[model samples]
Structures are given as C-alpha cells and as structure tokens.
Target chain A: MDDLPSLPAKLARLRHAHPGDFNLSRIDPAAQPCSRGGKAADKVRVEELAVELDGLQNRFWADRRHRLLVVLQGSDTSGKDGTVRGVFGRMSPLGVHVVSWKAPLGPERERDFLWRIHAQMPGNGEITVFNRSHYEDVLVPVVEGDLRGKALQRRYRQINDFEQMLTETGTVIVKFMLHISREEQRVRLQERLDDPEKAWKFDPKDLEVREHWDDYQRAYRDAISATGTRWAPWHVVPADSKTHRNLMVATVLKATLQSLDLRFPPLPKGLAGVRVK
Target chain B: MDDLPSLPAKLARLRHAHPGDFNLSRIDPAAQPCSRGGKAADKVRVEELAVELDGLQNRFWADRRHRLLVVLQGSDTSGKDGTVRGVFGRMSPLGVHVVSWKAPLGPERERDFLWRIHAQMPGNGEITVFNRSHYEDVLVPVVEGDLRGKALQRRYRQINDFEQMLTETGTVIVKFMLHISREEQRVRLQERLDDPEKAWKFDPKDLEVREHWDDYQRAYRDAISATGTRWAPWHVVPADSKTHRNLMVATVLKATLQSLDLRFPPLPKGLAGVRVK
Candidate 1:
C-alpha cells in the first residue's frame, strides 16, 4: 500500500477511461489502496462516511437539480448487496432507490435492451442504484458465446451512446466493477454452502458460470475498455476485504457527491417569516 | 401502553377487512396501541424489528416462492418516507424495492392507472413497497370531483379485481393508511417549512390539499371500504407519533412475514457434501 496515492488520485488511477490494452489481471483485488488505516480504523471511517453521506443525500434530494445513477457490476458473490448496505443504506429510502436487475422476462425480452433500463432512471433529485446493470447484457452474452464479433462490438457502442446521452442530460453516472480474486470467490461460494442460512444463495448455475471465470474476466476487461467514457467512466474496486470494499466505495461516492456541491433549494420568497398557525 | 395488545392481536384489530361503515375519524392518530413502551423504548424495538426484518428478507428473497407488496397511502406530511426509513431501512437494499409514485407523467397519463402500477410489481421472492400507490387515483380524482358517482365506484371495483388477481397469483398485499390528524399535519407541515433541510418536502400544493382535508378523508374511507378484501387487507396505522407509527408498521410487517412460514429453500439435493474446489 506504500505506493498507493491519495483517495482521489487512486480513483483516477483505477478508472477505466479510454479503451485499449486494459488488463484486469494486473490489478490485485486484495490491495488496500484506499485504506486510511487497519481493519478497525477503516470500519470506523466507513461508518463516519456513511453518516456524512446521509446528510449529503438529504441536500441532494432537496436540490432537485441533479440525478445520480450508480451502477454496480461484478461476478457472483462480488458484494453488490454488501456495498449497497454499507455505502448507500444510510440515506432515506425516499431519496435512494435500488434496482436489482435479473434476466429478462416475457415483455422485457420483447423490447430492446435499454428499454427496461430507461424506465428505471432516477427522477430529478433522486439517486438510483443498479445492482447488476446494462453491462450484464454485454458480459453474459459474450461469455456464453451467444454474442461475438461485430454484434458484440455494436452492443458496446450502443451502451456507450446510451450512457453518454444519460450523462448529457441531468444524470451523473458512477459505475463500479467490484474486483475479487477467484480464490476469494471460492471461499465465498463455499461459505454459502456451509452456512445453512445462506444455502439458498448458493445457486448451482453459479458453479457452471465459475467454470468460465477466465472468459468472464476477459469479457469484463474488453467491455470496460470499450465503453468506459469520460461521461460514465468505470471504477475498479478491489473488494477482497469486505471492510476495505465498503471503505473504497464510500470514499469514491463521497468525492463524487462533494464535487457536485449539492445544496438545498433556496427558501421560497418570504417563506421564512411566514408562520404556520 | 398496558392496553397495547400482542403484536399478532394488534395486527388483527388494526386490519380493516370487509370494511363497512369504516370511520377514519374514529381512529385516534395519537394512539399507541402498538407501542411496547415509551418513545425511547419503542425506538429501540423498532430498530430491533428492522434488523429482524432484514434477516427474514434475505430468506424471503431466497425462498422465491411468494411476492410481497406493501402499499403505504397517506396525506402529505403523514410520514410515508419516514416510515420506510424507520421500518425498512435495515433490510439489504437488494431484497427490498421502494417505488414512490408521483403524478402521472406523459406516458403514464396516456395509459390506464393500473398500467403503470402493473409494470412495477415485485417478482417472485421480492418485496416491493409503494410509497404512495394506485389508491391516489381514487383519492385525488374524487377530491378534485373529476371522478365521482358511478365512475368512482367503477374504479374501486376495478382496483378490487386487480388486487384479487394479484393475490390469487401468489402476491401477499399489505396496505396501510397512515392516519394523522389535521392538527398534526399542520404542525408537521410547519416543521418542514421552519427546517431549511426539510423545506423541499413542503410543497405549496399540500396546503391546498389540506383545505380539502375532509373531502379526502371521506374519499379514503369510501375507497378503503370498497376495496378491502380478505386477500388484501388495509390497516389503519395511527401515525402522529413517528415512533409508534414505525412500530405499528414494523409489527404488522413482521407478523405478515412470519405467517408465511418463510424458510430457505431446502438444501439443493446433496449440496451439503459438495466442495467448491
């Protein structure tokens, strides 16, 4: 962790902006680049940031000028739910909405890929979190070999265009790809099986998907390389340690919200002096 | 507090099934029929129930057998958002989804009221909360005089049929009307104006609606009477005290979930002996 930069600088370093020559393997998932101290200290910092986020979220909700869309993408057991609870849970449910995308059903499959996604976008002054997002369209098909060559490239371009359009509007998009090592995933999957309460989360299909781990990684790298734009850049979060994962996500989110300079809408004229009787 | 019944009994007493001559004014908004103790103790219990709700939610999501839909209807400043935070916040965001309904927009206005609502229903094993729900169509229209006489009656019948069909198809519906007095609403609305942070929540239109409070209350009584069914019951929750409100809602929800006999899907065949490696 010695060479790790400041939080903002580390965010910059981890961001996937322009395409080409991006390697997912080079990044260490266990690295604590955003850690302010050891486990106990980081836990406290995460709690502090969560409180601060709750305050900012209230103001942001009141501002009504900007909309925030946070996208969390990762492999099975990559901590998407954990990240949401740790980072975004402090905000009032009125302000923050979470959409956990699953496989398309009848009506959804009939429409284009982005149709369902467009319907779930945040309204003015709302923050929306997508658990597994549109990126899954690019990742799943590619790894399953159902989409390839020019077709796959076309989808990536489509996603980039869609995100660019959203950003051009009032939406601020923050995407995080929770990076975890295969060994860590193994442990998590095993724990799911070993713990009776978690048994239902252990899907047999997840094992089938794990067999294509390398292919999925390659797909993720290529997808990120192709679509990560300045408008909706992707942040690679090292998530081996659950505490550090929460810490890194909280740090990045705080910085993004701070940069927005959120403020409550000015009181209506003469409203302050008006009394409610 | 001594008069407070057991959670299950309280839930039964609060439920308005087969509603007939149900008087909204008869229910005291300041009643603490669900409170276990004073404000501080009730607050602690609310927190505890929230955590338990979180655990049950995990199993519910994993169970994937039933869909839960919670509809919260109240006049403005009746604490819809507050109840969500105080009661539902502890759950993992992945399992609980909240859809706060606003006035019909362009496309929504083009469609029938239930069209937009049907599109947002929870899938199997998921819990969906509607902050302000399809019931708004009945209240707003009736109060505005746009829908009345036979037309309003027809809509209520339509809603009953819709809800019955949902329940028949494995959805468990719980509806709550957050009952607050006009004086309480006035105080709450005033607090919103005085607190700069809360000013955004205070819409001028709410004041206008308050002028028609009696009409809205009558509309609510009629609507709830027409639509309350054995399959989908409505609960009148005294919501003037925020702590008691949360307690009541949480208690009802916890009882509802418990009644389902929610359990994790039986361990997949021989999965207990299966190794990740």
Candidate 2:
C-alpha cells in the first residue's frame, strides 16, 4: 500500500463493478488494469504489496477491533488457489483460515445456504477466505434455471443485507470476481488435462460447466450488477495472468486494511505504569 | 533450501548443541556461524530462503503427512518476537501459528507443567511455533531454586519423553535457543524502557530475572544439555545481531523441511480418471 499508494482511486473506479448498469464487456480479462509497468515491474510491485500486507496484518491481529472476510469467486481454472498461495502465503495461521467450499453436502444442503457460510466467517482479529462462496448459490442456480425472477432477486438481496450486517458488526468484507477470457479458460482447462500433476484438478464437471461458458458469464454479470453493494463492492480482477490477478487482489486487500489505520492496543492495566489517572 | 543447499550439514554440525558437553560459553553471540557472505549477501540469502520456504509449506500443507513444532526459547531481550516477524512472517495463517507463552495461569498451574504444552502441539499438516516454550518451566523453577537436583532432573526427563512421543507420532521438532550476550541484553532492556512505544514490552519481572544473569545462564546450559536429544536438538543461534538470528533459523527450518521432501498426496479415487489399481 505504501508503494502502490498512487493507485487507490484508479484501482476502485477501474475494477469495481457498479450496480444496475455495470457492463462486464467493457473490461478486458487480459488487460493489466492495475499493472504499474511491464510484467517485471508489476511482479516487484506485488511483492511490495505482500510485505506491506504482512505488516498491516500484524497490527490488525494486535488491534483485535476488526474481522476480515475475503471471497474469491471465479471459473474453475481462474487462479483462486494460486491467489491464496501467492497473495496470502505470508500471513500467519494464528489469525487466518482458508475455506475452500465445494458443492453442498448432506447437512449443508439441508440447511439455509448461509448457515454453513456463516459458521466459517472470521471471528474478531481473524481472516477467513472463501475460495468459492455463497456467490456460487447465486451463479449455479441461476445458470441452471432453478432460481430466477423474484427468487433470484431475493438471493442477491439476501447477500447484500447479510454483508451490510456483518459490516455493521465490525467485519470488513472484500469480494473478488476473477474474470478470465473464454480463450484463457480453454487453454487452462487443456493444461489441467494434459499435465499429470494438474490432471487431478481437471473435473469432468468443470467440462460440463464450461459447455455453458457464455451462460455462466451472463450469470456472473447479473449477479455483480445486483449485489455490488456499498458495504462490499466486488472487485472484478482480470485473471488471464496469474501474477496480475494476485497483484490486484493483494493491492486492494492492503488498501482496505490500511484504510482502517490499525494500531497497537493500549497496554493492559498496571503494566508499563499506564493507569486511568 | 535449494539455493542455500550447500550449507545444510555444516549448519547442523556448527550450531547444534551436543547432549552433555553443550558448552554455551564457547559460542560467541556476535559470531556469524551461518553467514553466507557479509550482511548484504546474508540478507538476500534469507529472502531466497523465505521464498523457498513458502513453496515448501504449500506442499507440506497439501501433503498432510507431518506436523511441525518450532520452539524459540531465549532471554527477555534476545529478539524472539523479531524472529517471528522476520523468519516466519512469509508463512500463511492457514498452516503456521505463532504462540507466545507467558507464565502458565490458573488451571494450567493446577496441572503438571507439560499439560498445557501438550495441548498446544501441532496437528497434522500444521506448523506451530512457540515464541517461548515449556523450556521456561525448566529455567525459571531451577533459577528460583523451587526445583533442584533430582526433582529438576525428573522434570527434564519428562519433557524429553513427551517430545520423543510427539516425534514418534510424526511431528518434526526444531528447537532454537536464541543466545544473546548479557551486554546485548542490557542495551535492549534499556531501549525498551526508554522508547515509549516499546515501553509496554518492559516487564518489571524481567528486571528481577536479569539480576540473576549468571544463574540463569547456568540453568539454560543445564536445560539445553539435558533436553537436547536425537529427535530434537537445540540450535544455539548467535542472536546479538537480529539479521543473523533470523537468517540462521530460516536456514535451519528450510533444511529441516527439505529433508522431509514433501510431495502431493494421491488424488481421490474415481476423480482424475484414477480407478482401482
């Protein structure tokens, strides 16, 4: 944040999707909207953001005044896992947990969708990441035609209100939608199938989902338009390049944590001679 | 680990304290036993080690084959907190936890000493760092003469047995004794008292402990010699210089994890086209 200090306004206005008339087509997934210079300069800038983030998290952990929820939602091969390892690898397990959500299982499917999601939310002085999240309930259901019209609108409203309440209670929410081009997805999917080590990540279900690529993209755009609230605006990260995807998310996270101006808490009573006087 | 690969054997041999004749005096707190070159080169090497460490941790978390316990034991001003920030700052909160142990209280005191220590050991696929550890039980009691002779010897044996059991169950243990000179400690303690921001760290009890410097050193020497074993040897870090202390610990941790040679576990059956053999 200290080094990438100049991009705050540009970052928000460029990548943040606005409500109602948000146009996903205007943004290019391959473009480096937040890149400082060439790839080399951008890579170095990301490292700076990572170091600054580590420093801020130290204070945030000590501050104990705020909780953090980071949602990473994207296509199957759009680099959510990479973002976790590259962007958040430096933070300690003392305060952060990464929750990779899959399809709803027996009991999770039996309850209201947010029940399991709510259970995983970060507590005070902690960070909980959803590698995928309730955002999926909106996406998959809408794409499959199971949820639409009044029901679809209701789901989006539920997410917006839930996020607002969390913010009201001192949790900072940051949502990211990793937008990768259709061509990039094809290449990534092929790579997963071709590389034996990566073959394990290649789900036949992903192939079935990829067949409805355009439908999924349309679903994502609608969800962003409906749910991009003031409390938790969605940062649509360009995800064709893994480094830029990580760089943008790291920059935004640092900026958000920095905005709080976290500080060390006051010393405990009778220690350091700090008394009420 | 790969870049600093040349120094592994020498690293273990030079700093590792032997069981009975673990003479703490011969080791100079200011000496650079593990310095690659000068300060600049050592700083760069530490960064490389950190990056490599990040990569290994990713595999370790996925491997889920072993747990890791790192014990950082030292005097009041020997840079334990700084080491946590500098050496392990790059790790994610998903896999690594830094626990600062204070004097055990209430129920912790009600039970035997190892009770709380055992409760905090790392689970599978996790790493837990003890900013201070159960070793304090050995040091404080013996220094105050509340425990001595055969009683103290029994406590040491109990600790050794507990650690050995943990190793037998698949936890890799690395113990570091951050050895700083008495004069270095005096300066640090004075700085803590003088700097208002750092004043909170100055404990009044620490001053009382510093007065018995020689007795504490004797106690430390005894503890290290007694508890140092095949499963967990004490790495006596020359920690007057903060950079070297972090550098040495990072190198040792990298090497230790490297020896494990973690790999990705086999993918789940019926997924990735892997069926019965």
Candidate 3:
C-alpha cells in the first residue's frame, strides 16, 4: 500500500489475474449453520484476530479524530452482512455507524445519487459502512440496461469524481467486491429457497441477473479498472471461503488503520472534581 | 399517564410544590463504586418500568418506524451519560444513536444553533439520545451573555418551533431536567477530586456557574415552562442520589416509548427463505 505511486499498475495486474472459481454442493444447514471452522488452527487465529480488532476498535474510539469508511458490494449471497457482523462484532457501538442504503427515499431519489451518500458520512473518529453504495449507479444500471448507452457511461465519470472527493476530505474508502462463483451462488440460492425464514431474501429477478453473470462480471471488471485509485483501491476479495474472506478484510483494515497512526489524546488535567460518585 | 388531561393538572400541582432538598448520603447505590441497596417499593416499581422499556426497545427495532428521541438536560451532576449507559445498555446497536453535544466547532458556531442538532436527527425506527441539546442555545447562551439583549429571546422562540417541527414529523421528543441540591453537588464534586481517574473531568469554570446556581435554576424553569407541550412534556427528576436519578430517567424513557405503541412490521414476504445454519 505504501507504493502509492505504482498502485494503479499493481491494481491492473490484480484485475488481469484469473479469479477463483470453485462451487460446492448446497447443504441445508441447521440452527448453527454459521461456522468458523472445526480446525484448531482456524479457531485460534480467529480468536486472536477478534482480540486484535477489539483493540483497534478501542483505539479508533479513543482517538476520535481519524475516520474510516468501508464500502461493501457483491453479487447476491456474497455475505456482505455476514462479513460485517463477523469482523466488527467486537467493535464499540459508539465508534461504528452502519448505513444500509436501500432504494432511495423520496427526497433522496430527487437528488443526484451522491447526495444520499454524502449525508451518511461519519463525523471525526468514527467508521461509516456502506452495504451497497454509489457504485450501484454504475454496476446495476450498466448490467441491467436500466441506464443504457450514453446515460450509463456518464455515471462512471460522476462516480469516480464523487469517490475522489470523498477521499480528499479525510474519508478513507475501502471498497470490497466479494467474488463468488456461479455454482456457489446457485447453492446459496437453493438454500434460500429451502429455508422459510430466508425466503424473504430471494427475488425472482435475482435469478434473471444470474442468467447475465458474464455481462455483470464484465461490468464489474470495467468499473474497478476505471475507478480504482491510490486514494481508494478496490479489493476484489475471494469469497468462496467465508473464513478466508474475513481474514483478508481484517488484515487490510488493520494495516490501513495502523498506517494512520491513531492514538488516544491526553486527558485534560485535574478533572476528578466532576465525578458524582 | 394515559389520562393525559388529569396528568397535566397533577404536573402543575407538582411544579407549584417545593421538592424536598436532595440528600445523597441516605440513598444506597447498587453498582460500580459499591453495590448496596434497600428494597424501596417505589424503586421496585421503577425497576419494573425499566424492564418494560427494554421490551419497547425491541419493538422499535422490529417496527423500524417509531423513532424515539430522548433529550437529557440538567446541571453538572445530572447523570445524563450514566442514564444512557444504564437504560439503553441492552438495546440493539442497529436501532440506537447517542449524541453528546459539547462546545460547537467553528463552522457550527457560525450557523444557527439548530443546524448541528438537525444533522443528528435519527432515521425511521431509530432511537436517538441527545445529552444536552438545542436548548443550550437558550440555557447556556442566556446565562453566559454570549447573545446579549434582544438576541437571547429570539433563540428561545426558534428552539420551541424547531422541536414542534420534529414532533410533527413523527419524532417523539421526551425532555428531562435533572434537579440536584447544593450540598449534594458539593459531595459529588469532592468525590471526583478524591479519585484519580475522575480528576480530569473537573473544571474551575464549573465553579463559576455553580456560583450562579439560582440564576441557572430560574433560567431552566422559564425555558421548560415556556416550551413544554402536550406533544413533548418536560419531566423534572430529583437527581441527588445516583440510583434514584438513573431509575427516574429510565422510568421516563420507558413511559415515553411505550406510549408510542410500537410494533414490529411484517417481514417482506420475498425474504422469508433464509435460515441461519
């Protein structure tokens, strides 16, 4: 990450590499379907990582000056919610703000796309998370032909400038595109169909998008290549294994926050007289 | 409380009567510095009220529509932070937001007082707790002479209308004024000086305000009486005893949210498929 001058070249090399493509069978998981791993090594590492993240969360809370923004985007069943809950489970509630941007509300729809995004920015010393963000203006509209031809291309330029402005204004944007294979997605889709509680999460339209998988992939690749920059690099996370994906994300966050050099400010002198008990 | 018409008369009567001066030494605390308590019948009733409030928090989370706004205002030893921590400890992080307003930043100081307050308003179904809010425009500035002469009266009018607007837009505002005695304040201030960690919380300037305690009380009484409405009533809680204060604040919150008649909305039928394994 320190090699900021050559970040574009590095990202291009990553974008060009062959991606992971492993799809396993669909299994009907019981009440305890959420698992880390049975292996001792995995358990120990996850525990250590959890503790480290807790410390990081405390530092972020205590410093209360530097801010972080994490942008998560992925295909259906890519585990955006799961990733957040797993990684930030131990974080202090005060230090983190999670905003799940749904279909725009009345006032939001009337404004330019970035209007709502800008409104959700965290104040100093906090973290703001975007479940899916302004990137959708480019990705969804492009692949779905919701904004076709000239309109679709225009969105790309607007999004790039929007992200760049956010970066310049002390917002550290970490965008993650969770990459899962078609077969793996199919399994998840089936699991959703089978579980009554999860039935609400499924959409017939989602299957239609699955049909245009290659088209969406191309759109994603183009979007990443066109917009990723030194200020905000898109990390194309391998999502076939949930554990591995969480680890990679945690590591990136740790490195980035550490680089920022956050520290607790010195307490003001002689405040003992303020306590009530 | 359901009999609002009669309750207003009762509140009027309570306002006219002089409250017995607060004595901190008599009431026993059951947490933190030491845990001891008497099973007072009134305390038991308040504790039950708090438990009911927890249920309301769950309902707010489920409904995602009835947002609760709690405004805590008082002199220094009012237990605003403690009330938030104790009462909302079990509430879902997803549905709650706490804002502690201190001195305004340069940009904030340039704007009208309500500017920063409006920015922190919670979305639908979210509960936002403000520790010292827009009322400070009148309370602090009026006492401090920061806004001299005619300017002071304008702020009170503006704050009243701003709060009315929030109520009109479905935001329930419950304001509280914590009342403590001079002798009790002296004991708490002394305790803070005796403790190492609490020493940093004291300010010599706090004593400047303490000197004009009667002036502040008069300002508070006028502000509350002028602005308090049926839609958003102000509750004056005796807060010399930390346990009694925490319980009273919790009781007020419980009553306010429960009055909203919050209920969970049905899940979108389409997302019913997912089950946690």
Q: Which model scores highest in lDDT?
A: 1
Q: Superposing all C-alpha atoms, what RMSD in Å does each candidate have to the true structure?
A: 3.6, 6.0, 7.8
Estimate the TM-score of every prediction: 0.92, 0.75, 0.66
Interface RMSD, model 1, angstroms: 1.8
Q: List the residue pairs that clash in candidate 1.
A: none
- Candidate 1, after superposition: displacement of residue B129 in Å? 1.4
Q: TM-score of the second chain in each model?
A: 0.95, 0.93, 0.81
Write one digit per residue (lDDT tens) for candidate 2, span B170-203: 9989899999999999888777665655655667
The lDDT for every candidate, in the order shown, is 0.87, 0.81, 0.65
User: Where is model 1 chain A poorest over a 10-residue stretch in terms of lDDT?
Assistant: A1-10
Residue A150 displacement (Å), model 3:
9.3
Measure candidate 1: CA RMSD: 3.6
lDDT of 3 by residue, A1-277 (tens): 3333313342333322222321211211121122355545555665567658767766776676667889888888887866775676445445667787777789988999889888889877778778888887787778767876677667766876787787788777777777777777888888767755455456667777788887877777767766676667777766766766666566567666777776755445655234532
Which stretch of 10 consecutive residues in model 3 chain B shows the poorest summed lDDT?
Answer: B27-36
CAPRI level of candidate 3 = incorrect
DockQ of each: 0.56, 0.17, 0.17
TM-score top scorer: 1
